[model samples]
Target: MRFSTLKSVYQCKCPRCHQGDMFLRGKLLNPAQFSVMNKNCSNCGQSFEPEPGYYFGAMFISYGINTALFIAAWVALSVIYPDYSLKLLLALLGLTVLIFLPFIYRVSRSIWISIFVRYKDEDLPSSA
Candidate 1:
C-alpha cells in the first residue's frame, strides 16, 4: 500500500476513503468521549467496527506508540541536557504522556484500522 495512505490515518479519516471523518465532533481533551468514532464512513459506508473486539488489538498499537514516544523523549532530553536528573526526566515524560493520551488513543485506533484496510482506487472521487 502507498505511504500516502498514512495521511488518512493521521487525519483520522476512513481507511478506505480519506474524505470521511473517523471521529465525531466533541471536546477531544475530554477523556470520556475522546474515542467517539463514527459508526460508518459517511463517504464510503465502510463500517468502523469490523467485528466485536476489533479494537482490542489497538491497545497493543497504543502501547507501542507510548513506548516510542517515551524513548524518543528520553533520548532527546539526554542528548540536550546530559546532566539532567532522572527525576526531572521522569516528570517530563509523565506530563507528556498525560497531555497526549487522547491523541495517542485516537491515532492508535486509526493505525490499527489502516493496517487491516486498504484504500481502493474506486473508492476515491474522480477529482483525484
Candidate 2:
C-alpha cells in the first residue's frame, strides 16, 4: 500500500515503507511512553535511528510547532477576551504546550526522520 508523505508523517509511520509504525503502539493512553520509538521499521527494516543524536534537529521542529501553537492561542484568546490579563495569556500558553507536547514530540521526530529516509515502493517481507 502506497502512502503519501503527509499521511506517513502525520500517522507516524515509517518513512521507508510507510507501513510499520515508527513508535510503539498504545502511546496515546500512556503519556510517558509517547516519546518511545522503534529502533527500525518492521516492514522495510529501515533504521529509525540512523545514528546517535540524529534527532537533535527535531528539537527545532518541536520549537517551531510550539511557537505556532502559542501564537494561535494568543490570537484566539485576544479574540475571545479582549481584556485578557497577562496571567491568563501565560496560563493558556502553558496549557496549550502541555496538551500538545506528546504530539509535537512524535511529529517532530517523524518529520526529522522523513527528511532523510526516502519511501520505497517495494516492501521487505516481515520476519514475523
**lDDT string, candidate 2, 51-98, tens digits:** 999999999999999999999999999999999999999999999988
Write candidate 1's Cα lDDT for 31-75 as tens digits. 788889889999899999989999999999999999999999999
Candidate 1, residue 8: CA error in Å?
A: 0.2
Worst 10 residues of 2 by lDDT: 119-128
Q: Identify the candidate with maximal TM-score.
A: 2
lDDT of each: 0.88, 0.89
How does residue 2 of candidate 1 score in lDDT?
71
C-alpha-based local distance difference test score of model 1? 0.88
Who wins the lDDT comparison?
2
Q: Which sections of candidate 1 miss by over 4 Å? A: 124-128
What lDDT does candidate 1 reach at residue 67? 96
